[model samples]
Each structure stands twice: as C-alpha cells, then as structure tokens.
Target: MTEGIRSGTAVGSFWAEEERCGGRAVALPSWLLTTSNEEVAATVARLYGGQSRSRDRQQDLFELTLDNDAIAVNVDGPEAVVNRLVLQQVEEHAPIHVCDGFNFLQPMDNAGDPCGCPESVFDRKAAARSGRGPKPDARLAFRLAAAPDLVIFHLTSSTWEFSDSLSAAVAGMERGDNGAQMTISLQRKAVTTRSGMAVSYVRPILSVIQQEFAAPGQLRLAA
Candidate 1:
C-alpha cells in the first residue's frame, strides 16, 4: 500500500479522503444489500457494456456507500423485481453539494446535459445554500432505459416514525401519505465523468431522511 494507506482496493470506489480541515471526506463505503457484488457488477456492466469500450469503464457504474449500520435495509434488482426495492433499505439521506461529496456534479464539458446535476452531499449543500431546494438530476434518471426505472420518492412523516412499510411506500408510492411527501425534499443524481459516473453515500443523507420520517435524535457535531 502506498503511503501506508490501504486505499481500499475496491473496483468501484475511492480511497477514504479527509478534507483540509481534517474532517473526513468522500469515503465510498458500501453497505451492500441483498444486492450482490455480482448483481451490481452485472447491472452496471450491462448498462455501459454496449458503448465502445474505453480505458476508463469505471464512470458508468455508480458507487453508493452507507455507514454499515445506517442502512436499515437494501434490496437488489434483477431488473425484474424493480429498483424500488433498493430504496426501501436506505437510511442515509444527505443532500448533495459541490463542496461536499458531489464535486463531480458540475456543468458538463459536452452537451450531454445542459445543467450539471449533483454527484454527492457537497453538491447538495451548494444547491441548498442557493435559492433552489433539493433538485434531482434529470439526466441520471432519464439515462437509464426504464419507463419508471429510477424514480426517487421523498416521504416525510409527521411523527418521525420510520417503518418498513414507510420505506415500501417511498419506493413504490405514487402519492404521499398525508402530505408526508411534502415534508421531505428529494433529488436524483446521475454521475457521468471521464472516470465514469459515480456517487458516494454519506451519513447526512440518512439524517435528512430520518428527520423526514422520525423525530430528531441526539445531535452530534462532527469533530
């Protein structure tokens, strides 16, 4: 390992990084669901396979890592069962921002997308600071060849109760239960870069999702 750092040798992730302030940054840790490395690998490869092979095939596959314990659940797709199953288990819900994890989401160099979508929490933070609320990346959703392929549903609960049933609704519900959808902000991000599209999951996302569904828990400031 270089510099005595293991630099995690995962096929689709980055080495854990720390910011200038010594705060940890961009750690593409995965809390794998029923989704197997094989399934993720297969889906990603299939999505990007037909395209002319490039030296860097990495960009096509997205990497979302949740704090191992934070993920209450995760479901994999055969592209048959439905991607909604995957959303059911998610607990991490940080907003994307440019300064945070979503540095990849800036104006694209090409006409692929006129506006840059968020890639990570940093991108969400930058957008939040601006007048705009949570905006999901359209291209990311559209790029996938599904009619209802990658829909992101935002669910907000009044009493702060997060139940598996609630997750089921978030993934599959077309309408919110009692303005619960109105309470939470939802956004979708499609990562496209030279290295291939990639997205990392952080704890803040979980916090927001939790806030939307459940009462505020103990507040712990980052060191």
Candidate 2:
C-alpha cells in the first residue's frame, strides 16, 4: 500500500502527527541530529519523560508510527519502564511521518479503537499563524536546529531528571501523572524556518535530512 491505512500489528506506536500544533506552522521537513556520542534511541525517550538523563539500558532506539486514527511513539526500544507509544485516536486524515518519509491516511478504526478527538480533528487555528506574509505566499517556514546536543532520559517510577535543560523535563508532562516518555533534541537552526519547538516536533524536517543515510537501519519505524 503506497498510501493506504493499515491496522493489526504489535505496534510500537502508530507514529505521531507531523503538524506543529503550538501555532504558526513554519518548518519544512529537515534533519536534526545530536552528536554521534548521543544515542538516537535514548534521545527519543526523553520526549515523554521530559529533559532527564539516564544511564539505563532504555537508550536503545526511537520509534514513531502513524496509522489511521492512531499516533504512537516508543522513546526507546522495549523494556523501558515509562515506555508508552501506544496512543490511538488521532485526526481522521493526518501525516504518518518518520525519519525517512511519510504519507497521509484517514482512520478506519472500529469500536475497539482509542476514544474520539475532544476537539475538531483538523483544527489548525493554533498552528496556523497568519497575517499578511508579503502579499501572501501560502507557505509556512520553520528553522531547523542542525546537530544540536540532545539528552535522552528514562523516568523511573519517581522524580523527573534531565541531562540537558529543565524545560525539557517539564514539557514532557501530559495529563498530570508524568509516568511516560520524554526526550529533548537541541542544536539551533540559526535562522530556522519556524518557531518555538524543542526537538519532538521537528520530525517532518528530520525525515528530509536523513536522505543520504536512508538505509534500512538508519531509518525504520518499529512495527
């Protein structure tokens, strides 16, 4: 299926969305990497846990999945305590992006699917910062942080900790009970094409930057 929704699988995560929901979508697909010393997988986990550092084996791999109405993510490989990527109930039509390439698909979930979206699925009111861009060039811009230093962490069933910045850890809070994933990606896009985002939302750009190393191992979402 070049572009068809799929269901049924030991999903690491159905993948996350590609839209910058904070407001003013201003980024093109790009590549944001940490030093070779920083493990990519561990850096991914901090996303749910916030900015925390860990010396655990959780720093394995990062997986993103977007299938139908579901957006899943696994910060590290299996075996992490705060491992939670299995989130369903996403916009009906959304982008299924990874570090390589992605596509859009509508949801076909059944009764067992995650709940429904509390708000409008395609609500772009936040990400659509519009005014009058030089007569109107319908294109949004985002700055890409190239080779920023990233720190990945594992949240024990306890307090929050980080190897980078405290802001990263605080941002990882979801509903209230911060018992999940957290990762912070940094570098500095110089003149990034977009606005405020740590590292989690820069995915669309990462996919494009990984073109050269686009091998099976270099980029592949877990199933």
Candidate 3:
C-alpha cells in the first residue's frame, strides 16, 4: 500500500486546501546579507541534516530532502534577501517514480492490481523527460503534518536553526551592504493549481518567525 493518507491504495489525490499567509519584507543586519549561496546552503544542511540533492545556479534554488521523506526544503538565494524558504511534504510514489515522457497520473499507482501503464511506474529518465507528465494533483499542496518528530524537529527546530543561520549570515556581511531584502513564506501550492490552507496550521509557524526575529524589531510579520 502507498503511504500517507492511503488506506488501501486505490490511487486517489491527497486533497488539501492551499492556504497563503501574507509575507512581509524584513531587514537583516547587512552583515548576514552578504553570505554566498554556498555558505547559506551549508548552514541550512547542517542544521536540518537533510541530504542535498540539487542546486540550480540560474534559479538560485537549493533542494534537500530529509532521510525519512518527512519534508523537503527549497532555499532560493543570491537575490537581495534569500527569496523564499519553501517546505514541501513528501508523499509516497510521487513524481520520482514516473517514467520520463509519460503523462503524470493522479496517484501513479494501482488499487489492487498494477495499472500495467508505463506512467504508473518508473521507466527510463529520458522517457519521462520527453513530454509533460500528468497534470498536477489538485488535492496536493505543501503543508505541515503532525507526525512523531515532524512538528518538533522539522517545523520548530528547523525553523529555529534557519533563523539563527540568517542572523549569523547578517553578522558576517560587510558594513553597509544594505540592498537585498529576504522573506520566508510558508505556502501551499496545488499540483496543478492553487489550493486552500487552514489558518490554524499557519498561525504557529508565523508565530515562531515573529518570536525569533521580530521581537528585536529586526523583522516584521505581514500576516
């Protein structure tokens, strides 16, 4: 059976409302703003302990997935402030399993018997790359789930460490390097479209950022 909200694996979309909490432009001590992308990535990985899988220089995007698939973090940087720190939850039998060029299926699996469809399972990477995959799953979006250590470690601890890193980064910036602006946005994007998110789940995460940086008046929370 597939994991995460799966009962018997009939291949249904994991539906969740995508919610957006407003974001604010915050100021960092110019010192922290000067660190290179490499330094920022290192600091995030050390604190999160996730394996770094990919980095795109053009996009200034860095991706890391935790050992347990509990979460994946995307750190976009080299801009004024780190553009955004996005956290996406990992689901079982996701796009990684789909063969290249095959249309992406909703769940990409079988209920009782295998779908016998190439798109349902892994094929050559090139094949999967040939064409656009299936449409994004409408029910899917990035959000926090309350698993054993997920909330305490991934949500609380990870955010805390990231904040510390940013603070340290600012301290290292040269005196008077004040041009970039950075913000952390916790959001939910549907596989193909926008989705709705719950306010309850969003509030605490916002609170954490507020307490960590805004308390000293260094940053502000827009939502």
Candidate 4:
C-alpha cells in the first residue's frame, strides 16, 4: 500500500496554510487587520486588544480594529521579506509572468524561453502602470513584538513605492543581527499628476527600529 510513498518519491506537501491579513475584503482601504480566519482574529485580539466586527463582502469577514496605524514587528532576517514583479490575469491565481525587473524568472513564451522585460526599474513601473507589464508582488513575514513567541503573521502588497524601496530596506536589515526589530505601518499620500488630477492612496511602510549588538565584554572576549 505504501510502495509509491517512499521518502524521496513522496509527492505530497506538508506546508501549513498561512494566515493572512489585509484590506482587500473591505469596501474602503484602511490600516485595520481584516481577515476571515478565526485564528488570525484571536491572535490580533491577544496582541492588540481590539474588538472585531463582522464585515460582509461576498461572505462574512472580521475586521480587527486597532487604534494605531503602525505595529511593532520582529523579523527573523532579511529573508523574511521579498518583492517581485508579476503579471497575472486574476488576483487569486498564480501569475503568468514573474520577473525581478532585470530578468524573467519564469518563461513567458510558448517555446519555454524567457521573454524580454524592461531593463530599468522606471520603465518596468511605467509598463506595469500602463497594463503592459508585470506589477510588484511584495510579501513580508514577521511576528508581533508584543507576542514574539506567538504565531507569525504575513502581509502582502502590490504597491510600487513599497517595491521601489525594498532594496534599501533589505540592505538596512542585512546590517542588523538576527531577530531585528522593525515597525510596519500604513502611510497615506496625495499627489497631483501632470494633467492636474489629484490622487490619494495608502502604501505600506517598514522601518527599522533598533539593531541588536553584542556586549562590550563579549566583543572583547571574541576579539
């Protein structure tokens, strides 16, 4: 019965389903942690001490209402965050074209050959905004500073500004030791286009709080 289930030949996956929080299910974009999972709601309550209200979209979803827009987080390392360029037909499905702004990570042509993409980040952003290329697919994983031992939370965004600043953010994280402290927040900004049309939007922001350092005696001992 287990003949085809050998250690190396097994084809099943044991990955746990990740609990997510975002503003997609809400009528208006906000910083509140909105999720449909009970586990996520409980975690948010324990950490942030907020009451949840049922918000109906196509179905019932809970919004974890908190007072603050920013939350302190502890990241394992720079690897916990990633940003990529992706193009897909639907929001819920996997992307057809995936790239890193310089090269294609997945083949876009029927011949199994990688297709050409914009050589510069600016050009890539323009193409994506114009619906001719891939857009940013940014993901982050971290634990709340208040409950560092609790469950890890994941957040995803498609904001171009967040994607553009990822390189610098990762570089800052690299300079810090393991389990770096940071703050994740939502920032709203308004700008006028060249045609004098004003637009307002909110984008996610991540900033380093403090870097851990070795004790002076420990450093001397190591030296």
Clashing pairs in 4: none
lDDT of 3 by residue, 5-48 (tens): 11121111111121223322232111111112455445445543
lDDT per residue for candidate 4 within 1-223, as digits (tens), equals 0000111111111111122463222112445565556676677677656665466563546666564667887666655666777787655656788767656656545323444776777787788877789887766666677776555556656777656555455565566545467777767778999999998766777776865522111000000
Candidate 4 off by > 4 Å: 1-28, 35-43, 46-53, 57-61, 90-93, 107-115, 172-177, 192-198, 212-223
Write one digit per residue (lDDT tens) for candidate 1, span 1-223: 0001111112222112222232213322332211224454355435433222223335544433232233121111111111110011113444222111222232234323323445454664455446343322110001122212322211111111122233343343223211111111112335557878686332212111221332112111111
Task: Tell me the RMSD of model 4 versus the true structure.
Answer: 10.5
TM-scores vs. true structure, each candidate: 0.17, 0.19, 0.21, 0.67
Q: What's the lDDT of the predicted structure labeled candidate 4?
A: 0.57
What are the RMSDs of all candidates, in order? Answer: 18.8, 17.6, 20.7, 10.5
Give the number of the best model, judged by lDDT: 4
Q: Model 3: what TM-score?
A: 0.21
Tens digits of per-residue lDDT, candidate 2, 1-223, equal: 1111112212122111223554222332222221224344343334432233233334543332211121122222111212111112145422221110011122333323532222331232222123111010111111112212232222111001111122232233322322222232222334324666445322221112211221111111222
Candidate 2 has a TM-score of 0.19
User: For candidate 2, what's the RMSD?
Assistant: 17.6
Worst 10 residues of 2 by lDDT: 132-141
Clashes of each: 30, 41, 25, 0
Who is ahead in TM-score, 1 or 4? Answer: 4
Error of 2 at 160 (Å): 26
